[model samples]
Target: MADNILRIAIQKSGRLSEDSLKLIKECGIRFDNGAGKLKTNATNFPAEILFLRDDDIPGYVEDGVAHLGIVGENVSEESARDVDTVHKLGFSRCRLSIGVLREHDYQGVSDLQGKSIATTYPRLLGQYLEANGVNAAIHEISGSVEIAPSIGLADAVCDIVSSGSTLLSNGLKEVETIFRSEAVMIASKHLSDTQKTLLDQLLFRIKSVQAAKN
Candidate 1:
Protein backbone atom coordinates (compact mmCIF):
# COMPACT_ATOMS: atom_id res chain seq x y z
CA MET A 1 0.00 0.00 0.00
CA ALA A 2 2.44 2.65 1.25
CA ASP A 3 5.15 1.19 -0.97
CA ASN A 4 3.20 2.22 -4.07
CA ILE A 5 2.58 5.80 -2.94
CA LEU A 6 4.80 8.72 -3.97
CA ARG A 7 6.80 10.27 -1.14
CA ILE A 8 7.40 14.04 -1.18
CA ALA A 9 9.82 15.77 1.14
CA ILE A 10 9.40 19.41 2.22
CA GLN A 11 10.77 21.78 4.79
CA LYS A 12 9.26 21.24 8.23
CA SER A 13 8.79 25.00 8.74
CA GLY A 14 9.57 28.45 7.30
CA ARG A 15 8.35 30.46 4.31
CA LEU A 16 9.36 27.68 1.93
CA SER A 17 7.27 25.18 3.87
CA GLU A 18 4.24 27.44 3.84
CA ASP A 19 4.50 27.99 0.09
CA SER A 20 5.08 24.28 -0.59
CA LEU A 21 2.02 23.26 1.42
CA LYS A 22 -0.03 25.97 -0.23
CA LEU A 23 0.99 24.71 -3.65
CA ILE A 24 0.09 21.16 -2.66
CA LYS A 25 -3.30 22.28 -1.45
CA GLU A 26 -3.84 24.29 -4.63
CA CYS A 27 -3.14 21.07 -6.54
CA GLY A 28 -6.14 19.57 -4.71
CA ILE A 29 -4.15 17.39 -2.35
CA ARG A 30 -5.51 17.43 1.18
CA PHE A 31 -3.52 16.40 4.22
CA ASP A 32 -3.23 17.13 7.93
CA ASN A 33 -0.09 19.05 8.87
CA GLY A 34 -0.65 19.50 12.56
CA ALA A 35 2.07 20.88 14.75
CA GLY A 36 4.92 18.43 15.44
CA LYS A 37 3.69 16.06 12.71
CA LEU A 38 6.70 14.92 10.71
CA LYS A 39 4.78 13.02 8.02
CA THR A 40 1.29 12.97 6.60
CA ASN A 41 -0.71 11.23 3.90
CA ALA A 42 -2.92 13.00 1.39
CA THR A 43 -6.54 12.01 1.78
CA ASN A 44 -7.35 12.07 -1.95
CA PHE A 45 -3.96 11.55 -3.58
CA PRO A 46 -1.39 8.81 -3.88
CA ALA A 47 1.17 10.80 -1.97
CA GLU A 48 2.84 11.05 1.45
CA ILE A 49 4.59 14.16 2.69
CA LEU A 50 7.74 14.03 4.82
CA PHE A 51 8.62 17.14 6.81
CA LEU A 52 12.34 17.71 7.18
CA ARG A 53 15.05 20.36 7.33
CA ASP A 54 15.49 22.32 4.11
CA ASP A 55 19.09 21.10 3.75
CA ASP A 56 18.22 17.44 4.27
CA ILE A 57 15.49 17.33 1.63
CA PRO A 58 17.96 17.04 -1.27
CA GLY A 59 19.84 14.14 0.29
CA TYR A 60 16.63 12.26 1.07
CA VAL A 61 15.46 12.64 -2.50
CA GLU A 62 18.85 11.53 -3.83
CA ASP A 63 18.77 8.46 -1.60
CA GLY A 64 15.27 7.65 -2.88
CA VAL A 65 13.96 7.85 0.70
CA ALA A 66 11.58 10.44 -0.67
CA HIS A 67 10.69 10.10 -4.33
CA LEU A 68 10.32 13.86 -4.71
CA GLY A 69 11.28 17.01 -2.82
CA ILE A 70 10.43 20.73 -2.77
CA VAL A 71 13.59 22.68 -1.97
CA GLY A 72 15.24 26.00 -2.66
CA GLU A 73 17.71 26.08 -5.55
CA ASN A 74 20.29 27.36 -3.07
CA VAL A 75 20.14 24.28 -0.85
CA SER A 76 19.82 21.89 -3.75
CA GLU A 77 22.88 23.29 -5.54
CA GLU A 78 24.83 23.64 -2.29
CA SER A 79 24.17 20.05 -1.34
CA ALA A 80 25.42 18.94 -4.77
CA ARG A 81 23.11 15.96 -4.45
CA ASP A 82 22.36 13.65 -7.38
CA VAL A 83 18.73 14.51 -8.10
CA ASP A 84 16.71 15.68 -11.04
CA THR A 85 15.19 19.15 -10.80
CA VAL A 86 11.64 18.40 -11.87
CA HIS A 87 10.14 21.89 -11.77
CA LYS A 88 10.53 25.45 -10.62
CA LEU A 89 7.75 26.41 -8.20
CA GLY A 90 8.47 30.15 -8.73
CA PHE A 91 8.24 31.11 -5.05
CA SER A 92 10.77 31.91 -2.35
CA ARG A 93 13.15 33.49 -4.82
CA CYS A 94 16.47 34.85 -3.60
CA ARG A 95 20.06 35.35 -4.63
CA LEU A 96 23.42 34.21 -3.32
CA SER A 97 25.54 37.39 -3.09
CA ILE A 98 28.84 38.61 -1.85
CA GLY A 99 28.78 41.47 0.67
CA VAL A 100 31.43 43.60 2.20
CA LEU A 101 31.50 46.35 4.80
CA ARG A 102 29.53 49.34 3.58
CA GLU A 103 32.50 51.63 3.89
CA HIS A 104 35.05 49.38 2.22
CA ASP A 105 35.06 51.44 -1.01
CA TYR A 106 33.97 48.34 -2.84
CA GLN A 107 34.51 48.39 -6.60
CA GLY A 108 33.65 44.99 -8.09
CA VAL A 109 34.20 41.22 -7.97
CA SER A 110 37.88 41.84 -8.51
CA ASP A 111 37.95 43.58 -5.12
CA LEU A 112 37.52 40.11 -3.55
CA GLN A 113 40.97 39.06 -4.71
CA GLY A 114 43.11 37.71 -1.85
CA LYS A 115 40.31 38.45 0.64
CA SER A 116 38.61 35.95 2.95
CA ILE A 117 34.84 35.50 2.49
CA ALA A 118 32.71 33.71 5.06
CA THR A 119 29.73 31.78 3.84
CA THR A 120 27.66 28.64 4.34
CA TYR A 121 27.75 28.10 0.58
CA PRO A 122 31.46 27.55 0.09
CA ARG A 123 31.10 25.33 -2.97
CA LEU A 124 29.04 27.88 -4.87
CA LEU A 125 31.22 30.73 -3.70
CA GLY A 126 34.36 28.85 -4.64
CA GLN A 127 33.02 28.11 -8.09
CA TYR A 128 31.96 31.70 -8.61
CA LEU A 129 35.34 32.94 -7.51
CA GLU A 130 37.14 30.49 -9.74
CA ALA A 131 35.06 31.59 -12.70
CA ASN A 132 35.70 35.26 -11.95
CA GLY A 133 39.43 34.65 -11.52
CA VAL A 134 39.26 35.84 -7.90
CA ASN A 135 41.57 34.18 -5.40
CA ALA A 136 39.64 34.88 -2.20
CA ALA A 137 39.85 32.48 0.73
CA ILE A 138 36.56 30.80 1.56
CA HIS A 139 35.71 30.53 5.27
CA GLU A 140 32.87 28.07 5.62
CA ILE A 141 30.64 28.72 8.60
CA SER A 142 27.34 27.13 9.59
CA GLY A 143 25.56 30.39 10.48
CA SER A 144 25.92 34.12 11.17
CA VAL A 145 27.66 34.70 7.88
CA GLU A 146 26.43 38.27 7.75
CA ILE A 147 28.34 39.25 10.85
CA ALA A 148 31.62 37.81 9.61
CA PRO A 149 32.94 41.09 8.25
CA SER A 150 31.93 43.08 11.32
CA ILE A 151 33.67 40.65 13.66
CA GLY A 152 36.81 40.40 11.53
CA LEU A 153 36.19 36.72 10.75
CA ALA A 154 36.34 37.51 7.05
CA ASP A 155 36.72 40.49 4.75
CA ALA A 156 33.38 39.77 3.13
CA VAL A 157 30.41 37.36 3.25
CA CYS A 158 28.61 35.35 0.67
CA ASP A 159 25.04 34.55 1.65
CA ILE A 160 21.41 34.66 0.54
CA VAL A 161 19.86 38.09 -0.06
CA SER A 162 16.13 38.57 -0.08
CA SER A 163 15.11 42.10 0.95
CA GLY A 164 18.72 42.98 1.75
CA SER A 165 17.50 44.16 5.14
CA THR A 166 19.78 41.73 6.93
CA LEU A 167 22.80 42.99 5.08
CA LEU A 168 21.85 46.62 5.77
CA SER A 169 21.50 45.88 9.46
CA ASN A 170 24.87 44.15 9.44
CA GLY A 171 26.61 47.12 7.81
CA LEU A 172 27.27 45.19 4.61
CA LYS A 173 26.51 45.97 0.98
CA GLU A 174 25.86 43.53 -1.84
CA VAL A 175 28.74 43.38 -4.29
CA GLU A 176 28.21 40.38 -6.52
CA THR A 177 25.46 37.88 -7.22
CA ILE A 178 26.80 34.38 -7.45
CA PHE A 179 23.50 32.59 -7.94
CA ARG A 180 19.78 33.22 -8.25
CA SER A 181 17.50 30.76 -6.48
CA GLU A 182 13.84 29.94 -6.16
CA ALA A 183 11.69 27.11 -4.82
CA VAL A 184 12.16 24.09 -7.06
CA MET A 185 10.89 20.53 -7.18
CA ILE A 186 13.59 17.86 -7.23
CA ALA A 187 13.14 14.12 -7.77
CA SER A 188 15.12 10.94 -7.35
CA LYS A 189 16.64 9.63 -10.55
CA HIS A 190 15.26 6.18 -9.83
CA LEU A 191 11.51 5.84 -9.51
CA SER A 192 9.17 2.89 -9.83
CA ASP A 193 6.67 2.96 -12.71
CA THR A 194 3.80 3.68 -10.37
CA GLN A 195 5.68 6.45 -8.62
CA LYS A 196 6.63 7.97 -11.96
CA THR A 197 3.00 8.05 -13.05
CA LEU A 198 1.96 9.68 -9.78
CA LEU A 199 4.74 12.24 -10.13
CA ASP A 200 3.60 13.06 -13.65
CA GLN A 201 0.06 13.58 -12.43
CA LEU A 202 1.26 15.77 -9.60
CA LEU A 203 3.38 17.87 -11.94
CA PHE A 204 0.43 18.35 -14.26
CA ARG A 205 -1.72 19.58 -11.41
CA ILE A 206 1.07 21.84 -10.18
CA LYS A 207 1.45 23.36 -13.63
CA SER A 208 -2.27 23.91 -13.85
CA VAL A 209 -2.29 25.59 -10.47
CA GLN A 210 0.60 27.83 -11.47
CA ALA A 211 -1.02 28.63 -14.78
CA ALA A 212 -4.24 29.74 -13.10
CA LYS A 213 -2.19 32.32 -11.21
CA ASN A 214 -1.08 34.06 -14.41
Candidate 2:
Protein backbone atom coordinates (compact mmCIF):
# COMPACT_ATOMS: atom_id res chain seq x y z
CA MET A 1 0.00 0.00 0.00
CA ALA A 2 3.00 2.28 -0.10
CA ASP A 3 2.61 5.18 -2.50
CA ASN A 4 5.29 6.73 -4.66
CA ILE A 5 5.11 9.98 -2.73
CA LEU A 6 6.75 9.91 0.71
CA ARG A 7 5.24 11.84 3.59
CA ILE A 8 7.27 13.88 6.06
CA ALA A 9 5.88 15.50 9.17
CA ILE A 10 7.24 18.75 10.58
CA GLN A 11 6.38 21.24 13.28
CA LYS A 12 3.43 23.44 12.36
CA SER A 13 4.79 26.48 14.23
CA GLY A 14 7.21 27.62 16.90
CA ARG A 15 11.00 27.25 16.99
CA LEU A 16 11.48 24.28 14.72
CA SER A 17 9.04 24.98 11.87
CA GLU A 18 10.93 27.71 10.04
CA ASP A 19 14.19 25.77 10.05
CA SER A 20 12.41 22.60 8.98
CA LEU A 21 10.88 24.35 5.98
CA LYS A 22 14.17 26.01 5.17
CA LEU A 23 15.90 22.63 5.15
CA ILE A 24 13.31 21.32 2.71
CA LYS A 25 13.84 24.29 0.44
CA GLU A 26 17.59 23.87 0.63
CA CYS A 27 17.15 20.28 -0.42
CA GLY A 28 15.72 21.67 -3.68
CA ILE A 29 12.19 20.63 -2.90
CA ARG A 30 9.53 23.11 -3.90
CA PHE A 31 6.09 23.35 -2.36
CA ASP A 32 3.37 25.87 -1.58
CA ASN A 33 3.37 26.43 2.18
CA GLY A 34 0.51 28.82 2.58
CA ALA A 35 -0.54 29.63 6.12
CA GLY A 36 -3.47 27.59 7.43
CA LYS A 37 -2.60 24.64 5.23
CA LEU A 38 -2.06 21.38 7.11
CA LYS A 39 -0.38 19.54 4.23
CA THR A 40 1.13 20.20 0.83
CA ASN A 41 2.68 18.20 -1.99
CA ALA A 42 6.16 18.97 -3.23
CA THR A 43 6.19 20.39 -6.75
CA ASN A 44 9.68 19.13 -7.57
CA PHE A 45 9.96 16.02 -5.42
CA PRO A 46 7.97 12.86 -4.88
CA ALA A 47 7.04 13.82 -1.34
CA GLU A 48 4.34 15.46 0.73
CA ILE A 49 4.77 17.62 3.82
CA LEU A 50 2.47 17.40 6.79
CA PHE A 51 2.45 20.32 9.17
CA LEU A 52 1.64 19.31 12.72
CA ARG A 53 2.44 20.08 16.34
CA ASP A 54 5.93 18.96 17.30
CA ASP A 55 4.39 16.89 20.05
CA ASP A 56 2.51 14.81 17.47
CA ILE A 57 5.32 14.22 14.98
CA PRO A 58 6.90 11.27 16.77
CA GLY A 59 3.67 9.40 17.11
CA TYR A 60 2.74 9.95 13.46
CA VAL A 61 6.17 8.75 12.33
CA GLU A 62 6.17 5.82 14.73
CA ASP A 63 2.81 4.74 13.41
CA GLY A 64 4.01 5.01 9.80
CA VAL A 65 1.40 7.63 9.02
CA ALA A 66 4.40 9.77 8.24
CA HIS A 67 7.46 8.20 6.69
CA LEU A 68 9.65 10.78 8.38
CA GLY A 69 9.69 13.80 10.69
CA ILE A 70 11.72 16.80 11.80
CA VAL A 71 11.79 17.67 15.50
CA GLY A 72 14.06 18.59 18.37
CA GLU A 73 16.07 15.93 20.19
CA ASN A 74 14.44 17.04 23.45
CA VAL A 75 11.02 16.02 22.11
CA SER A 76 12.32 12.90 20.36
CA GLU A 77 13.91 11.57 23.54
CA GLU A 78 10.99 12.51 25.76
CA SER A 79 8.45 10.88 23.45
CA ALA A 80 10.53 7.65 23.38
CA ARG A 81 8.88 6.76 20.11
CA ASP A 82 9.99 3.90 17.86
CA VAL A 83 11.36 6.22 15.20
CA ASP A 84 14.95 6.25 13.99
CA THR A 85 17.07 9.40 13.92
CA VAL A 86 18.16 9.79 10.32
CA HIS A 87 20.17 12.99 10.61
CA LYS A 88 20.93 15.78 13.03
CA LEU A 89 19.90 19.11 11.55
CA GLY A 90 22.13 21.10 13.95
CA PHE A 91 19.50 23.79 14.50
CA SER A 92 17.31 24.71 17.46
CA ARG A 93 19.97 23.88 19.99
CA CYS A 94 18.80 24.08 23.60
CA ARG A 95 19.20 22.33 26.89
CA LEU A 96 16.79 20.79 29.32
CA SER A 97 17.92 22.37 32.58
CA ILE A 98 16.79 22.38 36.18
CA GLY A 99 16.14 25.80 37.65
CA VAL A 100 15.26 27.08 41.10
CA LEU A 101 14.87 30.45 42.79
CA ARG A 102 18.03 32.53 42.36
CA GLU A 103 18.27 32.92 46.10
CA HIS A 104 17.77 29.23 46.79
CA ASP A 105 20.76 27.18 47.97
CA TYR A 106 21.66 24.55 45.37
CA GLN A 107 24.90 22.78 46.20
CA GLY A 108 24.31 19.84 43.84
CA VAL A 109 21.77 17.33 42.56
CA SER A 110 21.48 16.13 46.18
CA ASP A 111 19.94 19.49 46.99
CA LEU A 112 16.92 18.50 44.91
CA GLN A 113 16.26 15.50 47.13
CA GLY A 114 12.77 15.56 48.67
CA LYS A 115 11.85 18.66 46.64
CA SER A 116 9.06 19.24 44.12
CA ILE A 117 9.93 20.05 40.52
CA ALA A 118 7.68 21.44 37.79
CA THR A 119 8.35 20.48 34.18
CA THR A 120 6.75 19.59 30.88
CA TYR A 121 9.33 16.83 30.35
CA PRO A 122 8.33 14.54 33.18
CA ARG A 123 9.90 11.39 31.76
CA LEU A 124 13.29 13.00 31.15
CA LEU A 125 13.25 14.80 34.49
CA GLY A 126 12.26 11.60 36.22
CA GLN A 127 15.11 9.69 34.59
CA TYR A 128 17.66 12.31 35.60
CA LEU A 129 16.42 12.44 39.18
CA GLU A 130 16.36 8.67 39.39
CA ALA A 131 19.88 8.39 38.02
CA ASN A 132 21.10 10.80 40.68
CA GLY A 133 19.05 8.98 43.32
CA VAL A 134 17.29 12.27 44.10
CA ASN A 135 13.76 11.19 44.78
CA ALA A 136 12.04 14.47 44.02
CA ALA A 137 8.35 14.81 43.23
CA ILE A 138 7.57 15.95 39.66
CA HIS A 139 4.79 18.44 39.03
CA GLU A 140 3.93 18.11 35.36
CA ILE A 141 2.70 21.35 33.80
CA SER A 142 2.14 22.18 30.15
CA GLY A 143 3.32 25.83 30.13
CA SER A 144 4.64 28.72 32.23
CA VAL A 145 7.13 26.40 33.89
CA GLU A 146 9.32 29.36 34.90
CA ILE A 147 6.52 30.70 37.07
CA ALA A 148 6.42 27.46 39.04
CA PRO A 149 9.12 28.51 41.47
CA SER A 150 7.83 32.08 41.89
CA ILE A 151 4.19 31.07 42.36
CA GLY A 152 5.14 28.34 44.86
CA LEU A 153 3.98 25.67 42.44
CA ALA A 154 7.23 23.80 42.97
CA ASP A 155 10.64 24.15 44.55
CA ALA A 156 12.39 23.75 41.19
CA VAL A 157 11.56 23.78 37.51
CA CYS A 158 12.92 21.76 34.62
CA ASP A 159 12.43 23.17 31.14
CA ILE A 160 14.18 24.09 27.91
CA VAL A 161 16.49 27.10 28.22
CA SER A 162 18.02 28.81 25.21
CA SER A 163 19.74 31.95 26.63
CA GLY A 164 18.72 31.57 30.32
CA SER A 165 16.95 34.94 30.01
CA THR A 166 13.55 33.42 30.69
CA LEU A 167 14.77 31.83 33.90
CA LEU A 168 16.69 34.94 34.93
CA SER A 169 13.68 37.18 34.35
CA ASN A 170 11.51 34.81 36.36
CA GLY A 171 13.89 35.02 39.33
CA LEU A 172 15.13 31.52 38.68
CA LYS A 173 18.64 30.25 37.95
CA GLU A 174 19.71 27.11 36.14
CA VAL A 175 21.43 24.73 38.53
CA GLU A 176 21.80 21.63 36.35
CA THR A 177 21.61 20.75 32.69
CA ILE A 178 19.63 17.53 32.33
CA PHE A 179 19.99 17.18 28.58
CA ARG A 180 21.26 18.95 25.47
CA SER A 181 19.17 18.95 22.30
CA GLU A 182 19.11 20.01 18.66
CA ALA A 183 16.92 19.50 15.63
CA VAL A 184 16.99 16.02 14.00
CA MET A 185 15.31 14.08 11.26
CA ILE A 186 13.55 10.85 12.28
CA ALA A 187 12.20 8.10 10.08
CA SER A 188 9.68 5.35 10.61
CA LYS A 189 11.25 2.05 11.62
CA HIS A 190 9.69 0.39 8.62
CA LEU A 191 9.91 1.90 5.16
CA SER A 192 9.05 0.42 1.79
CA ASP A 193 11.87 -0.05 -0.71
CA THR A 194 10.50 2.77 -2.83
CA GLN A 195 10.24 5.03 0.20
CA LYS A 196 13.77 4.15 1.30
CA THR A 197 15.13 4.98 -2.15
CA LEU A 198 13.45 8.38 -2.07
CA LEU A 199 14.70 8.97 1.48
CA ASP A 200 18.28 8.31 0.34
CA GLN A 201 17.93 10.98 -2.33
CA LEU A 202 16.51 13.44 0.21
CA LEU A 203 19.34 12.71 2.62
CA PHE A 204 21.94 13.34 -0.05
CA ARG A 205 20.44 16.72 -0.78
CA ILE A 206 20.10 17.54 2.89
CA LYS A 207 23.73 16.64 3.54
CA SER A 208 24.83 18.79 0.64
CA VAL A 209 22.92 21.76 2.05
CA GLN A 210 24.33 21.23 5.52
CA ALA A 211 27.84 20.87 4.15
CA ALA A 212 27.52 24.09 2.17
CA LYS A 213 26.54 25.98 5.29
CA ASN A 214 29.37 24.55 7.36
> Which residue pairs overlap in candidate 1's backbone?
none
- CA lDDT of each candidate? 0.93, 0.94
User: Candidate 1 at 34: error in angstroms?
Assistant: 1.4
TM-score per candidate, chains pooled: 0.98, 0.98
lDDT of 2 by residue, 1-214 (tens): 4567799999999999999999999898999988899999999999999999999999999999999999999999999999999999999999999999999977999999999999999999999999999999999999999998888889999999998899999999999999999999999988988899999999999999989988
lDDT of 1 by residue, 1-214 (tens): 3558999999998759999999999999999888899999899998899999999999999999999999999999999999999999999999999999999998788988999999999999999999999998999999889999998999999999999999999999998888999999999998988898999999999999999999
Q: Where does candidate 1 stray beyond 4 Å?
A: none
Pairs clashing within candidate 2: none
Backbone clash total for model 2 is: 0
Best candidate (score: lDDT): 2
